[model samples]
Target chain A: MAGLTKQEGLSSPVSVSGLSYAYPAARGGNSRLALNHLSFDVSAGEMFGVLGPNGGGKSTLFKILATLLRPGSGRVRLFGQDTQAARGTRKRMGVVFQNPSLDLRLTCEENLLYQGRLYGLSGRDLARRVDDALGLYRLEDRRRDWAGSLSGGLRRRLELAKGLIHDPDLLLLDEPTVGLDPGARKELWDHLGRIRGSRKITILLTTHLMDEAERCDRLMLLHEGRLTAEGTPEVLKGEIGGDVITLETEQPDTLLAGVRERFQAEAARLGEHVRIERKQGHSFIPQLVEAFPGLIRSVHLSKPTLEDVFIHHTGRGFWNEGAQQESRGT
Target chain B: MRAIAALWSRELLRFFRDRARVVGALAPPVVFWFLIGSGLGNAFKMPGAAAGVDFLQYFFSGTLVLIVLFTSVFATISIIEDRREGFLQAVLVAPITRLSIVLGKVLGAATVGLIQGSFFLVLTPLSGIDLPLQGFLWAATAMALASLGLTGLGFCIAWKMDSTQGFHAVMNLFLIPMWMLSGALFPHSTAPGWLRFVMSANPVSYAVSALQHSFGMGSVALASLPLCLLVLTGFSVATLGACVWLARDQD
Candidate 1:
C-alpha cells in the first residue's frame, strides 16, 4: 500500500504511484484487472526484480514501465520525468522485451546498428558503439552471423548488447532469462552484474523464478495484481523470523495435528510432508522425531528462502498455483 | 530523419539478405505475364489494333503494374511479421515519431517495388514494343510513382492487420479488383459504360494510363497526360497520409 515518495530533489531512478491496468473483455468474458494500485521505487544503480508467477501481472507492469502500455490510472516516472509524457525519457532508457525482437535475417552487427540508429546514433559513432557492444557481449566473433543461427544463449546476449548499444541510463529487461538453461542463466546474471558494476546503470527485470529473484539487489513480490512484499531477498526471507522444518510421514494430516498440539507451532500439510516454521528448528527436529517416533519417516531443516517468504505472505506455494492456473488454461 | 533513414536501410538490408524473398517477389509476375499474355494473345483480339501489334505487346504495361503490385505487397507484409515477432514493438518504443516509422517503411517498400518493376521493364523488347530512351526514363518515373502509391496503400492495410492471412484476404478481395478495373487486364475502350465509369474512378487507372503513354503504346487514356500525373501524385500523397494516420498510435 506504500507508494513511492514524490519529494522534490529526491527522485529515484524509477518510481511508480497508484499504477493500475485492465485488459478489455474478450468475446463473452468481462474485463480483467491486471494491476491494482501497485507502487514501488527502484534506486539508481540497483538491480531490482519484480517477482511473480504467470498471470501475476509482472508482464503488465513491465509493459507499462517500458512505455509500451498506458496505465489505466496513476503515473510512472523515470529520472523525475513522466514516462508517458516525455519522448526524451525513452531516449535515456532501453528495453529488452520478453519476446525476441532481433530480426533473424539480419546479422548481429546489423541488428545493433539499426537499434543504435533508432536512438539517433549513426556514422562512425554508431559503428564504434556497435563494435563495443559486440565485444562486451563476447559476440564479436559472431557479428556477421545471422541472428537466427545463434543459440538461445547467444541470441539473448545479442539482445542485451543491442539494448545497451545506445548507452541508456536505465535498462528494462522483462524475463531476460526465460528460456535459458541453468548454466546460461547464471552466465547472463554474471554479465548483468558486470554491466551494472562497470557502467553504473540501473536495471529492472521481472522473473517468476525464485532463484533468479534472489540475485536481485531488491525484490518486489507481486501476486494477483497487487504488491505482496518488497525488500532485499535476505530481509524478505527474514520476515518469517525462524527456520523452516519439513517432515515426511506416513500420515501427514495426523502428524501436522500432533505437532500443532504439542509444540504450539503452526504446522501445515503439504502433499506427503508436514511443514512448520519455528525458532531453533534444528533442535525441534529431534524433538519432533521423538514425539512422533513411528509416524515420521524423514525430516528436513533449513533456512527460509524467497519461496518460503512468498508462501508465508500469500498462504500458497508459488509454482503450484501457477501450474494449476496454467493447466486450467486461464 | 535519421531514424527514418535507419529504418529504411534496415528494410533494404533484410530484403536483400533474404535471396528467397527477392526472387519470390520477382518471378511469379514474369511467369504470369508470359502465360497469360500468350494464352490471351491467341484467343483475344484488339478492336482497333494497328498492324504488327499483338495482345502480348498490349499487355506489357499491365504486367509491369502487376510486378509493382506483387513487390509492394510482399514488402509491406513484413510490417505484420515485424509486429508478430516483436521488432515493431522495439521500434515503437524508440524516440522517433510515428510518421517517421511509416515514412521509412513506405519508402522502403516503394523502393523495392520500383526496383522490381524496372527490372521487368527491361523485357519491353521481348514484347515487341520499341521504347525510346526518353520514353524509358518517363516509364521509370511513372513506375516509381505508381510503386510509391501502391506501397502506401499496402502500408495502410498492413498497419491495421495482425495476421498475414488477413492480408491475403484483403489482397484478393480488394487489391486484385482494383488492378483488374484499372484497365490493366483489358482496355477501357472495350468495356461497357458502367465498367468504363468504374475504371475512370480507380486511381490505379491513371497510373496504368501514364505507364502506357510512357511506353508509346496506343491506348484509350481515361485522362490527359498531365491529368494522369496529377492523379498519381495525389494518390501517393493520400495513401501515405492514410498510412501515417493509421500508424499514429499503438493499439
Candidate 2:
C-alpha cells in the first residue's frame, strides 16, 4: 500500500542543528544541561549509532529526535518539517525505548494489533500486519502468551516488532542491547541488520558497545552532552593518527622507559601491558626487543579499532571507565 | 481511529488479565452500594414522587456514580504502570496523535464503568425492582459520560508522571473531594447552604444528578440533562487539553 512505500528508504530523513536542552532543577538543586548545542543528521536508510557512556546525553538526544523532549533551543526537522511546528511528524516515526515497552498483561499478537489499530489499521489489515510482525520477530509461536512471561531478549524482540508494526519511516532505539546475553544480542543484531536491508528503515540507536557501533553504517559519539566525533567506522578508524600496539611484559615500566628513551614515544601502562600508538608496530618490535631484551612477553600489532579511535579522541577508555564508575558509585 | 481502538484493546486486555485488579476495580462499588445503599436507602425521597421509591433504587444511582468515579481514577494505575514499564514511550513514539491515546483510554475505562454499572442494573432486578429499558439506557449513558470525563481527567494527571504511588495520592486527593461533594452519598438538600452551593459547582454533582434522573426519580433540580452533558463535554475537552499540555515536547 502507500504506507508500504513510505517504509522504504526515506527520500530525506531526520536532520537537526544546534539542538540544546536543560533540565529544570529537581527540587532545589541547579538545573542540569542535558544537551549542549548537539548537531547531527541521519541520512536515509542508514543505521546510525550514538555511542556514549551513561549520562553522556545519548538518551537526551534520542528523546529530542523522537520529539518526546523538546529542545530548549535549536531546530529539529523530520522529513524537512520542523518537529515542533509540524503536528504530524510524529506519525512517521517509531521508537523502541531502553526499557521493554510491551504491556505485560496482553499477548504478543494482541499488543501488536492494538498498536496497529492505534496507528489506524484495523480489521483484516491489522490482523495481517500483526501476523507479519510476529513472524518477523519469530514470535508467532508465542503469540498467545502473556508478554510479562517472555524472557528479556524475547521481550526486546517483541518491542522491536511492535515499533515497526506501524511501518514508520524512522526508528529510534535507545540502548536496545543493554540487558541481553551474547547470544540474544547477536540474534537481535541479525534482526536489525535484516530490517535495514529489507525495509530500508532509517534506524538511529544508542549503544555504548564499540562492536555495536562498528556495525552501524555511521556513528556519532556523545560526551558531556556534545558530539565529540562522527563518521563511518572505517573512516573513523582511518582518522586515528596511527596504529595501536599492545605489548605484554613482566616489567611494563622498564619496557616503557626504554621505548620512551629510544623513540621519545608516549607509552600508557595498564597493569602488565603497555600500549603504544605508532606508524609501524611490527618493525619497531625487533628494535625494541634488542633495546630491552626479554622485557616483552607477547606483542600484538593491529590497526586502530573503534575503541582505539575513541581513546585517541577522548583520552580515556569509553566503556571501561564508565563501567568502573558505575560500579563504584553504586 | 485505529490508535483509539488499539489503546482501547490494550486497556481491556489489561483489565481482563489482571484478575486481582479487575476484581479490585469491581469490588468497591458493589460493596459501597450494598453497605451505604442500605443505610441511606430510606433517607432520600424525591419531592412530589410518592415516598414509595425504594431506598435501594435511590442509593443505587449514587453507587453507579461512585463506580464511574472509582473506575476512572483506578485506571490511572495502568497509565503509571505503562510508563514505568516503558510502554508509554512506545506509544508516544508511534506515528499517532496523542489525543487518540487519551480517547482510547477514556473509552476503555468507560467500558469498565459500563460493565460495573450493568452489574448494578442486574442487581436491581434481582431485588425485585425493574427499571424500564429506557431508564437503564439513560442511566448507562449518564454513567458513561461521567466515566469519559474522569478518564480524561485521569489521563491528564497520569501523563508523564513517574511513580504510581504519587499518582495514586493525587488521584485520591482529587477524587475524594469530588466524590464527597458530588452528593453521591447524600442529597444536596441535607447539605449546609454553603456545601450545597459547592455541590452545585462540582461537576460530579451534575453527573450524579443526571445519574439519579435515570432512576425515574424526576429530581433534576441539580442539573438538567443539557447542562450536565455540556459540562461533560467541557470536562472531556479540558482534560484532553491538559493531556496535550502534559505531553508536549520537553527535551
Candidate 3:
C-alpha cells in the first residue's frame, strides 16, 4: 500500500511513480494488468533486487526501466529524465537481459568490440576497453574464440563484461543468474560486487532466487502485479519477528487446527505443509511433535527468508520453477 | 553512422562464419543454372532472335538474379529469430536510432547479395557468354542495384514477422512467384497474355531486364536499361523507407 513517487530529486538512478502496465488482451481473454501502481526508487551505487514469483511483474518493470516497453500509465525516470526521451539516459544505462544477447558466432572479443561500437565507442579507446573487459572478466584467453564455444558460466561472465564495456552509470539486470550452477552464480555475484566496488554504478537486478535477493543491499517483493513488501533483507525478515516453522503432513488441515488450538501461534497451510510463526520456533517443534503423536511427517525451522517474507506479506506461497515455467512478462 | 557500420560488419561476419549456411545458399544456383541450361539446350527459338545464342547464354542473367535473391533474402531471415530471443534486443536498446539499424541490416544483406552476384559474374565464360570490360562493369552495377532493392524488400517483409516459418510461407506465397514471373525461366514474348501482365507489374522484372541489358541482350527484355535502373532505384528507396517505418515504433 505504501509507495514512493514524489520523494526528493528526480535525478536518482531509478525512480518509478504510479507505474502500471496491462498486456493487451488475447483474442478471447480480457486484458491483464502485469504491474499495478508500483512505485520505488533505487539510489545511486546501490544493489537493489526485485524478488517475485513468475507473472509477478518483475520483467514488466524491467522492460519499462530498460526502455524496451512503453509504460501504460505513470512514469519511469532514469537520472531525472523520463524514459520517453530515453536517448540520452539510455547511454547511461546498460541492460543485461534474461536472454543471451551475445552473437554466438562472433568471437568473444568481437562481441565486446561490436557492443562498444553500438554505444559509439570505437578506435583505440574501444579496443583498450575491450582488452580491459577481457582482462577483468578473465576472458583474455578466449578473446579469439567463438562465444558459442564457451561454457554457460564463461559465457555469462563474457556477457557481464560486454554489458560493462561501455562503462555506463546504471546497470539493469533481469534474472542475471537464470541458468547457472551454484558456483557460477556465486562467481557472477563476486564479479558484480567487484564492479560496484570499483565504480560508482547502481545495479538493479530481478530474481526468484531467495539467496540472490538476500545479497542485494535493498529488496522489493512483488506478487500478482503488486508490490507486497519493500525494504532491506534484514528488515523484511525482521517483519515476521521470530523463526518460521514448516511442517510437512499428509493432512495439513487437521494438523493446522490442532497446532493452532494447542500452540496459540500464527499457523497456516501452505500447499501440503503447515507453516507456523512464533518467537522461539525451534523450541515449539518438540512440543508440536509431542502433541501430534504420529501425525507430523517432517518439521523445518529457520530464520525467515525472502520467500517467507513474500508469504508473510501475501498468504500465497512463492511459485517455484516447476510452477511457473515462463513469466507473464514474455 | 559508426554504429550502423558495426552492425553491417557483424552481419557479414556471421554470414561468412556459418560455413554450412554459406555453402548451402550459394551452391544451389550453380547447379540450377548448369542442370537446367544444359538439360534444355538451345531448343526454343530466341524470343527476340538477334543471332545464334544458346539457352545457357540466355539463362546467365536469370541465374544471376537467382543468386542475388537467394543470398540477400535469406540474410534478412535472421532478423525474426534475433527479434524473438537474441542479439537484436541489445541493438534495439542501444543509443542508435531505429532507422540506422534498419539501414545497417538491409545494406549488409545487400552487400552479401552483391558479393554472390560478382562471384557468379566471374564464371560468365562457362556459359560461353563473353562479356567485355564495359559489360562486366555494367553487370556489376546492375547486380548492386538489384541486391540493394531486393534486400530492402526482404527487410520489409521480415521486420514485423515473428516466425521464420511465417516468413518462408510469405516467401513461397509471394517471392517465388515474383522470381518466376521476372522472366528468369522464360522471356516476355514466350509468356501468355495474363502472365505477361502480371510480370509487367513485378518490380524484379525490371531488375532482370536491367541485368539482361548489361549482358548485351537488351532485346530479350521489354524495358531499356535506364527504365530498369529507375525502377530498381525506386523499389530500393520505397522498400527501405517501409523497413525504416516498420522499425520505428512510430515514424
Candidate 4:
C-alpha cells in the first residue's frame, strides 16, 4: 500500500499489485482463473468501487482481500502490511460479505456483543460500542428481537452494525445491496454515506449496479478476470469523447454496414440496437434516418455513460456475455 | 479466551432458547434404549454378575455412551453451515487463530453434549442398577471425556465439509457404524474373533468400557479404566490438532 497507491503523503488503505487467484480443480483438469494479475490501490477515506459482471472475479478478489483465501501470486497490502501474514491487519478490516453472516437464532444485541468479543473488544467498552451501533443503525427498538425476525433491510443494518462494532479503519463490502429492494438499497447507501461523513474511513465495495457505481468516488471495470478500465464515473464516461446514438432497426446488420459506408463512422450492433459514437450524435441522427428511411425504426441519443465506455473498451455490451449478476460461491 | 468463551456460550444459549433442539438431542436415545433394552430383556443372562441383572441393566452403560455420541456429533454438524456461509465466516476473518476457532466450536458441542447426556442419567434407576453419588460423579467424568473426544472428531469431519447433506451421509454411514461397533448394541465377548478385534481397536469401545466401570458394570473384554481414559484423551488431542490444521488459511 505504501508506494502502489501513495500520492504525495497519503497512505493507501488497500493496495493490490499483480494479484491473481484460481480455484483448484475438482478433478485433474484445467482450472479457470478467478482473478488475473490484478493491480489497484484504494486511497484512504475514498468509496472505491470494484464494478464487474458476475463471475468476473469480484467475489474472489473480495475473499483474498478479506484474508479468507490466499493470493495465488503477488501481494495484497492493508495499510502497507502484507495480508498473507495479516493477523493485525484483520483487525483493521471490517468485511460485510454478500452472504448473510448473522446468527439468525441469536437476538440483535447478543449478535453485536459476540461480534465485539471476536475482535477482542469486551467489558464496558464493548457494551458502549454495541449500544452506539444499535442506535446508529436505528435498531435500538429491535435490540431484543431475533435477527431472523427482522426485515431484510433491518437484518442488513444489523449486519452492518456487527461489521463495524470493532470500528475498523477500512470497511469492505462484497455486493452489499444484493437481494434488496430499491428502497432498502437506497437506505443502505444512505447509511454508508452517513458513515463516511462521520469519519475519513476508506470503504471499498463490489457491485455490478451502474447507478451504485456512480455513487463511488472512483471505480474500476472488470470483465473475464481482468481489469478493463479504471477512473471516476465522469472521467470514464468522458473517455468516450462524444455522445452515444442507438438505432432501433429491423435490419441492424445492413444499417451498421450502410452507416459505416455512408458516414464513414464506427458502428457496432449491440443486441437489438445498432450503437454509434459520434461527436454530434443528435445531428447525425437526422442524416441516419433520412438516408435509411423506413429501414430505421427509431433513433435515440444520449451522452456517453459508463456502459458506453465499457462497450467502447471491451467491444461488447456490458450485459452481452453474462447478464446475470449472480455471485459464484467459491 | 474471551472470544472462545463467547462462542461457546452462544451455542449453549441457542440450544436453551430452541426448546426443539433440547428435545431433539435427547428423545431419540431414550426411545432407542427403552425399546431395545426391553425387547431383549428376558432373552439375556450374564455369566457372572449379581442376581437378576436383566438386559436393561447390562445395556445402561452403552446407552449412556450412545447419548453422548449422538448429541456431540449432531451438534458439530452445524459447523458445515458456519463454514459455508454464516457467523463463523465473520469470526474467521477476525484477528484470531485457527486454534481459537477449533477450541471454541469443539468445546461448545462437547459441553452441550455433556449437559444433554446428563439428563439421560435420571433414568438410570429404571435399569435397576445401583449407582450412588460417587458412581454418578465417575459416570459424568467418563461422559465428559467421551463427549470431548467424539465432538472433536465431529469437528474434524465437519471443518472440511461444504454441505449438511454430505454431513448427514457421514453421520449415517460412518458415525452411526462407529457407535454400533463400539459394543453399544451387543457384547464384545460373544462377538466373532474378527468383530472382537475391530471392537478392541475402536476408540468408542474404550469409552464404553470406561462408562461400564463408572456404572459398576462388568465387560468381559474391558480395557483398564486408566487405559481407557488415556485413549480417550489421546483421541481428543489428535482430533483437535487435525481440526485446527484443516481450519488454516492455506488448507
Highest TM-score: which candidate? 4
- For candidate 2, lDDT tens digit of each residue in A80-134? 8877754476767888888787888788887787777767677887788888888
Best by DockQ: 4
Off by over 4 Å in 3: A1-10, A258-264, A282-298, A320-330, B48-52
Q: What is the lDDT of residue B124 in candidate 4?
A: 82
Candidate 3 lDDT over residue span A71-106, tens digit each? 889988999888889888889989898999998888
Which lDDT value does model 1 have at A93? 88
TM-score of chain A of 2: 0.85
Better of 2 and 4 by DockQ: 4
TM-score of 3: 0.92
In DockQ, how does model 2 score against the reference complex?
0.56
| iRMSD value for model 1 | 1.2
- A35: Cα error in model 4, Å: 1.4
In candidate 3 the C-alpha lDDT for residue A77 amounts to: 92
In the order shown, the candidates' Cα RMSDs to the true structure are 3.9, 5.2, 4.3, 4.0
Candidate 1: tens digits of C-alpha lDDT, residues A232-296: 99999988759999888878778877888898886666667777888988888888888988998
Q: What tens-digit string does per-residue lDDT give for candidate 2 at B17-117?
A: 67876677678878877777676665556444325656666666667777777776677667888878878877776666666766777788777766766
TM-score for each predicted model, relative to the true structure: 0.92, 0.85, 0.92, 0.94
lDDT of 3 at A195: 94
Per-prediction DockQ, in order?
0.75, 0.56, 0.63, 0.75
**Alpha carbon deviation, residue B234, candidate 4 (Å):** 0.7
**lDDT, candidate 1, B199-220, per-residue tens:** 9999889888887787776455
CA deviation > 4 Å runs, candidate 1: A1-10, A249-258, A290-297, A321-330, B48-53
